[model samples]
Target: MHREISELIEIGRLLHSRGWLPASGGNLSVRLEDERVLITASGSHKGHLTREDFVVVNLKGEVLEGSKKPSAETELHLLVYRVFPEVKSVLHVHSINSTLISRMAQEDIRLEGYELLKAFEGIKTHETSISVPVLENSQDMEELSKRIEKKLREEKVYGFLLRSHGLYTWGKSIREAYIRLEAFEFLFECELRLMPLA
Candidate 1:
């Protein structure tokens, strides 16, 4: 348990250093062996996270440990863990590119013909394409979860955007998840730069 928390703390610091998490902009969580999630507490700055800055919550989003409240986006992380049993970590990153591209695209960001596409699972070549869904933002967590659930039911989601908000992704481990996060950020920046020429 301590090791898992330490890993999350390290990841939080790395993310903050990359400028993907500004202020209290993103959330990080790891699925424990017993299925409870160790997630960053609400409003805790990612750059300055401590062991106490994380809280444990069940799959239902109920707090089981720690003193602070979990992030408001807790349901989203729980949904990933529930829907995909293999996922061990879920990361929500609020980077400038994710925020901007989520707004620039109408509904989804279609990524194709990029070497970075290989960063996601099951992709070997740049010839293939995948569309990252972009949903309109809503403060109503339940409603937002429902909408996201609908997407999950229909699509092969590597990650998603909350229309001008941020990116949500999950992986079998924290390391894998962070790799995809970096890839997504790179693709988003490329797309933004090429938009004018399109």
Candidate 2:
């Protein structure tokens, strides 16, 4: 349990150093073996997260332990666990490339013919294509969650983005989740670099 908390803290520190989690702009969560989730608390800055900065919550988003409130984006994290039982960790980030690409893209950001596209699961080659559904940002997480569920059910998605917001990606572990996030960011950066700034 302590090791798991330390893993989250290390990832948070790494993300913060890369400027992907500026302030409290993002959230992190991992599912415990007993079906509870360890999540960053509300208003807790990922850059300086401690064990106390995290709280344990059930799949229903109710806090079962810890003194702090769960991340405001708690529902989103819970949704991933419910949807993908195999997934153990969730990582959301507010990086410049993901944010700008979300706005630049249409309804979904599609990537193809890139070697990094193989970074996502089940993809054996670059011949495949991936469309990351990008929905408009909403303060109402319930509504946004509903939209994501509908989209996820209709297709195979490694992750999604909130327009003008950020990216949400998950995996079987903290390492896998970070790998996917890093791949997505690199792909987005490549796309951005192809377009000249206004």
Candidate 3:
């Protein structure tokens, strides 16, 4: 538990410093055991997260431990765990590129022929392509979860974007999750740069 707690705090600080998680704009979580998860509390600055800022929740998003409130998006994290049993960590960040690019696209962001595509798991070269699904933003968590789950069945997704919201990515561990987040951000920026301005 100490290992997970410490790593969660470090990831928060790192993401905060990178301008990915600003002011309380993002949430993170790690699955612990089969029934519990460690997740960021609601409304806390990621850059200053302490151990106390994390709360334990069940697979159903019910609070199990800690004084702070679990992030409202805890269900989103739980959804990933329920869908992808291999996922260990989930990171969601609101960045300029994700926000901007999601708004410009209608259904999905098609990224192809990028050298960094290999940064994702299982890809060994830039010959592949990936289309990240973009869902319309909704305040209803259950509705959003259903949409995401449906999409997950259709593609080999590394992450997803919420229209005008942010990016959500996960991995087998905290470090790998962070690396995936970095990869997505880099690709998002590159895609933005390639677009011609009106």
Candidate 4:
């Protein structure tokens, strides 16, 4: 558990250095087993995360250990795990591209014909299209989570965006989650640049 926490913190620092997460803007978590998860606590700078900064939470979103409070966005992570049993890690970031793209898209952001689209698992060709869902931003974690669950019932998604908020991507491991985050950011930037000049 310590090792996993440490590795995640390292990735957090990397994301911070790259401007993916600025200040205290993002949260991350990894499912440790069927019942336990390691998550960054609320109010901590992701880049400067320490072992003590992570709290263990159960699948039900209850804190199991650690003195710090789990992230306010913890319920979203719990919802992902509940829906995708194969998912072991989730990464949320507040990069400019994700925030801008999410705010710009009315309903969904579609990535099609980009070679980088293959970065997401299960995609082997550039001709594929992925519709990343964007939901209205909300401060209520429970309500936001319920909305995400409802979306899950009707659609298959690799990730989703919170309007004017950030990007949320999950995977089978911390590494895969990071990769997907990178891919999403790249796609967002490409779409932004492709916008017609005003």
Candidate 5:
């Protein structure tokens, strides 16, 4: 648990330094044994997270430990955990590229023939294509989680975007999740840069 917390804190700093998590705009979490999870607290700055900034919660989103309130999107994290039992880490970031691309996309953003696509798991070649679904953002997390759950059941994607909000990605480990997030950010940037030419 300590190791996971340290890793998440370091990851937060790295993401913040890259400007992916700005002004407390992102949340992160890691699954634990017995269906419990460690998640960042609400209103905490991701870049400056510490052990004290984390809370333990059950798979149902009920607080198990810590005094701080969990992130407002805790339900989303729980939903992912329930949907993907193998997933150990989930990351959410609000980046300029993700925010912009998600808005420009009417439904889903497609990426193909990009070498970075290899960064995602199970993709061996850039010849493959990936479609990242974009969901309408809502303050009602139950509604948002239900919508995401429904889409996930239909599409097996490595990540997704919230319209004008941000991106969410998960992995079997924290490192893998970070890698996927970085790859997604790079892909979004590349797509945005080429849009004017198209």
Candidate 6:
């Protein structure tokens, strides 16, 4: 929908301004009805996206509209849609906290007893905990996607991190996805700062 596209553009600008998406280092997509998706194109500056910077693709990652090529990680977005039909938006961002904490984590980063944990859907109290999965990063999207798919089947998580790369989070809508992203960033920063004490 036009509104979703506009929201994505606005989110892109907001994320870029926060330094989460720098130099075209992130990607965003919204799942549409009929197994179609509207996604950002490769190599476009996230902060300066226009209507022309988007492409429509099917669940299979085939472009149905627009001239520009989809992001290299387009398959990853498609994988999320296939795995979670309820999810309407997926966001991938590169931030210092995410990048650092992901590398520091062995298999998954665990956050517990943080009031911010309530920012995630379903968690009503800070007594709960979440384990954000960390997958090894790779340039081969297919291979990476396969690995992620396997991990997701074993663990139902709101998000995951690509080792030394970035974070991937989704929600029922773009706004929810952005909220999760922000929450994850805040949690990551808190964890990172606490690492020295640990």
Candidates' TM-scores? 0.97, 0.97, 0.97, 0.97, 0.98, 0.97
Off by over 4 Å in 2: 196-198
Off by over 4 Å in 6: none
Q: Lowest-scoring 10 consecutive residues by lDDT in candidate 2? A: 103-112
CA RMSD (A), model 5: 1.2
- Per-residue CA lDDT of model 3 for 1-198, tens digit only, reads 899988988888888888888888999889899679999999988999888899999998888899988887888889988999999999999988898999988679888999999889999888889989999989899999999999988889999999999999999998889899999999999989988895
Candidate 5, pairs of clashing residues: none
lDDT of 4: 0.90
lDDT at 136, model 3: 92
Q: Which whole-number lDDT from 0 to 100 does residue 52 have in model 1?
A: 92
lDDT of 5 by residue, 1-198 (tens): 999999999999999999999998989999999999999999999988988999999998999999999999999999999999999999999999999999888779989999999999899999989989999999999888999999889987998899999999999999999999999999999999988753
What TM-score does candidate 5 reach? 0.98
Write down the lDDT of every candidate, Cα atoms only.
0.92, 0.93, 0.90, 0.90, 0.94, 0.93
The residue-by-residue lDDT of candidate 6 on 1-198, one tens digit each, is 899889999999999999999898989999988999999999989999999999999998899999999999999999999999999999999998899899888768889999998989899999989989999999998889999999888976999999989999999999999999999999999888888754
**What does candidate 4's lDDT look like per residue over 86-197, in tens digits?**
9999999999999999878877888899998888888999988998989998998888888888887677789999999999999999999999999888889989999876
Tens-digit lDDT track for model 2 on 52-149?
Answer: 99999999998999999898889999998999999999999999999999988866878889988889999999998998999988989999899999
RMSD of each: 1.3, 1.0, 0.9, 1.0, 1.2, 1.2
| Tens digits of per-residue lDDT for model 1, 1-198 | 899888988999999999899999999999997889999999999999898999999999999999999999999999989889999999999999999999889768889999889999999999999989899999999999999988887878799999979999989999999998999999999999998844
Best by lDDT: 5
Clashing pairs in 3: none
Screening candidate 4 with a backbone cut-off below 3 angstroms (N, C-alpha, C), the clashing residue pairs are none
Candidate 2 lands at a TM-score of 0.97
RMSD versus native structure for model 1: 1.3
How close to the true structure is residue 183 of candidate 4, measured as C-alpha lDDT?
A: 88
User: For residue 144, what is the lDDT in candidate 2?
Assistant: 88
Residue 91 C-alpha lDDT in model 6: 98
